[model samples]
Target: MTTSFIARTTLAVAAFGALALAGTAALAGDQDFALLNATGYEIGELYVAPAQSSDWQEDVLGQDVLSDGQQANIKFSRDEDTCAWDLKVVYSEDNSSAEWSNVNLCELSAVTIKYDADSGETSAYGQ
Candidate 1:
């Protein structure tokens, strides 16, 4: 190839690589939030997933449990264009679970699970 053509091609490739790196960095930007257990019971498992996903991700708590009135830090990365998320938590005693759906992570700093003794139901909300 001509010297000018080769030089132009190399410059273009370098620019492309830089843009790709920038995009990757943006997509991998830090995402972290606190999970509060206010359901009047200990939380055994915590799962988070993108709103579009059908399956819940692995437990964020791992071997740890979030006791009532306790909070745990959860960290993850989401696409820059995606802001919706889902959170699920299971109670320690009976494996009963509660889920909060379509939560906008951009507007949420914490997730709290609430349980009602009268209705025997659990609900979650973002704060």
Candidate 2:
């Protein structure tokens, strides 16, 4: 009886784990991507909005800061059908900002933001 109980519990746990993985797969969408900060400053705020949007959305980073050479996961629900996105970052050290537009999140799963304070320019690279 003890062996049977253990076997059933193990099977149930395995099934639950499979369901959890399926749910996670279903939640991943084209808008989900990794955001890498190669900028020379700590990012105090990060915003992502559809390219066609007139105004930037709420900061995706919230209270968290993305330090230089760090990465953050930017996820969107499966219902997000938009592919082209705009990104903006605000620096923590001086509050200077940078922006990128028309990034295709569907074709690119990762993005890196690079900044040059010398010329005050911002650029993005992705794969």
Candidate 3:
């Protein structure tokens, strides 16, 4: 595998075991995926919740910081079973944040979050 792919895989594997033991256990039919941070900031906290939920589930990143270009694997419980979801990323330096709404998690194996300084826009695309 390529170096970057190896790094991402290593991170994913490291996170999977730790996160599963941290009370976010995996389940059948879970929407396992990768979250790529292309936002050029250190992501302090990451939150994911169903589209209709008012509150986020939890800090999925836990104690980890997702630096620019780093990717983390996001695993969910089968009980979640939601197609639409919301994602929020808080930058570590100043707590500045961005949110992406109604992401279709069901069909996505990876989601790339990007920020454009010129437009002051943050968006996500998944595949």
- For each candidate, give its TM-score against the true structure: 0.70, 0.72, 0.73
Q: Rank all candidate structures by their TM-score, best first, as comma-separated numbers.
A: 3, 2, 1
lDDT of 2 by residue, 30-113 (tens): 568898899767889988887668988688898899999999998785364566666777778766666666666766778777
- lDDT per residue for candidate 1 within 1-127, as digits (tens), equals 1233222221112222222221112233343678877767888998877665898868889999999999998877545455556667766776666565555655566766666565555555556
Q: lDDT of all predictions, in order shown?
A: 0.61, 0.65, 0.67
Q: Highest lDDT, which number? A: 3
The per-candidate count of clashes, in order, stands at: 0, 0, 0
Best by TM-score: 3
lDDT for model 2, on a 0 to 1 scale?
0.65
What candidate 2 gets wrong by more than 4 Å, as runs, is 1-28
Which structure is stronger by lDDT: 2 or 3?
3
**Clash count in backbone of candidate 1:** 0
**C-alpha positional error of residue 90 in candidate 1 after TM-score superposition, expressed in Å:** 1.0
Clashing residue pairs found in predicted model 3: none
Candidate 3 local lDDT, residue 14: 25
Model 1 TM-score is 0.70
Measure candidate 1: CA RMSD: 20.0
Q: Which ten-residue region of model 1 has the weakest summed lDDT?
A: 15-24
- Residue 29 lDDT, candidate 1, scale 0-100: 32
